[model samples]
Target: MKDTAKHQGLRNQLVSLLEQKGITDKNVLEAIKKIPRHLFLNSSFEDYAYQDKAFPIGAGQTISQPYTVAFQSQLLEVKKEHKILEIGTGSGYQTAVLCAMGAKVYTVERQIELFKKTSVLFRKLGIRPKYFASGDGYKGLELHAPYDSILVTAGAPIIPKPLMAQLKIGGRLVIPLGEDVQIMTLLIRKNETQFEKHEFGEFRFVPLLEDKN
Candidate 1:
């Protein structure tokens, strides 16, 4: 009962934060609510898990801010049956939210240590995504090609070609693109050979590396 109450309170707080920031997608909001954010963090930072700020999770990488996670997820426009690909698996929080929303997620993480920890957390949460790989996220996941939606959690100087090739027609990819300064851009695969692009807003994230682990 205490655990249920804690989750409920976290949900309320998260919904309030999203609503305040104009995250109007009800499905996205519910997914973010249902996932236990506290479980993704170290116990020392669990109390602040619901806040709209990033927290360090060792290895110098931080779990993304909640609003950023919700905002990127809202852009994906995920449905119950969409096959989603996430390019980074930091702490697996966003992956948890994606699975909670009923999407079959295929995620990749470049950092082996982080990937291992995050994968264990996913198992502990009992949320089994379709695929989890510790490799080059810049290449995206090809085994599950032509994804309904793609999300890149790390910042890149430019859109990665392999990632572009993995998008299905009518599918959309939300990514943070730029070098030192970054803009969160959404790329929609309009057809077999054309892509429509739009910028969501300015944002900052760790650089998307090309090395495969």
Candidate 2:
């Protein structure tokens, strides 16, 4: 529960490594540095939490590698109080990162096992996302539609249509598109009917399951 001086020191080192890897967003880096990632993992994994690698949390999901988390967060260009929709809550590390950045996050998780576990963890950690749902990620939360940003943490076969339609104009949708290995894709909503697409290399992520309930 306590983030020690050693933990902060390791996080600072992680930020330095991310900078070397071309991460330029200071806010993203700061958020990463502030989040106590070890608390999101198994106690045995506490030693490896700050490394630039992903570690399995439980179920089939992994707490995303620090670099990937920072990269997606940087791509979104989050501003204070921006309404962000997170498609995969996973370990709630990414959720905490967005919350730490002052974004009002509405996060959905399909794995009921994980959703149940993480929802409790969020309160214990004092991280309050704007909303939390245990259901399909493909169907964006319509009640909270028109988001300022949408971040999909898992690999998707295609951009989920409902998510795109729910985006506010000028909002950024950052998702990875693929089966085994996903290509990070960014869609900036230009208007009601169109989105500007850009692909940024490749990343590996657990598949974003459609319906598991």
Candidate 3:
């Protein structure tokens, strides 16, 4: 529960590394700095929690690598109070970053084990999302649809159509698209029937699962 001076120093180093890697969004960087990343990891991993790498959480899901979280977050262009839909909650590290930016986040997790663990984590950290669900993220959180932005944390074979339908006009969806390897794809909603697409380089992520838990 304690974020000591050593942890802060390591976080500073991580932020510096990210800046050198071309992450220019200050808000995303600051959120990464402020969040106690170690708190989201297992006791065995606490020592290297700020090293910008992914570590297994539980239920076969990995807390997203720090650089990946920052990259997708910057692409999402979070605005204060902007409604955000996060497809995978994992250890809730990324959700905490969104909360730090004052975004109203609706996060869904497919693994029930992770959902329960991370729900308790939110209480301990005093972070809250607008909604949290332990269900298939492929369906998206339809009850709270039309988000200003949607962020998919896992690698998908193709963009989920439900997620596209839930994005508000002029909003963006940041997702990694592929099977064994992924290309970071950003889709911007232009109108009801049109979207602008862009692809960045490759990334590796746990596959986004459907109904199977």
lDDT of each: 0.88, 0.95, 0.95
lDDT of 2 by residue, 18-112 (tens): 99999999899999999999999989999999999999988989999999999999999999999999999999999999999989999999988
Clash pairs (backbone) in predicted model 1: none
| Candidate 2 ranges with C-alpha deviation above 4 Å | none
> Cα lDDT for residue 89, model 1?
88
Cα displacement (angstroms), candidate 2, residue 166, comes to: 0.2
Worst 10 residues of 3 by lDDT: 204-213
Q: Mind giving the per-residue lDDT tens digits that candidate 1 earns over 32-123?
A: 87887888888898778888889888777789998999999999999997999999888998988898899999999888889888878777
lDDT score, candidate 3, position 16: 97
lDDT of 3 by residue, 123-200 (tens): 999999999989898999899889999999999999989999999999999999999999999999999999999999
Least accurate stretch of 10 residues (summed lDDT) in model 1? 1-10
Residue-level lDDT for 81 in candidate 2: 98
RMSD of each: 1.7, 0.9, 0.9
Which residue pairs come into collision in candidate 2?
Answer: none
The collision pairs in model 3 are none
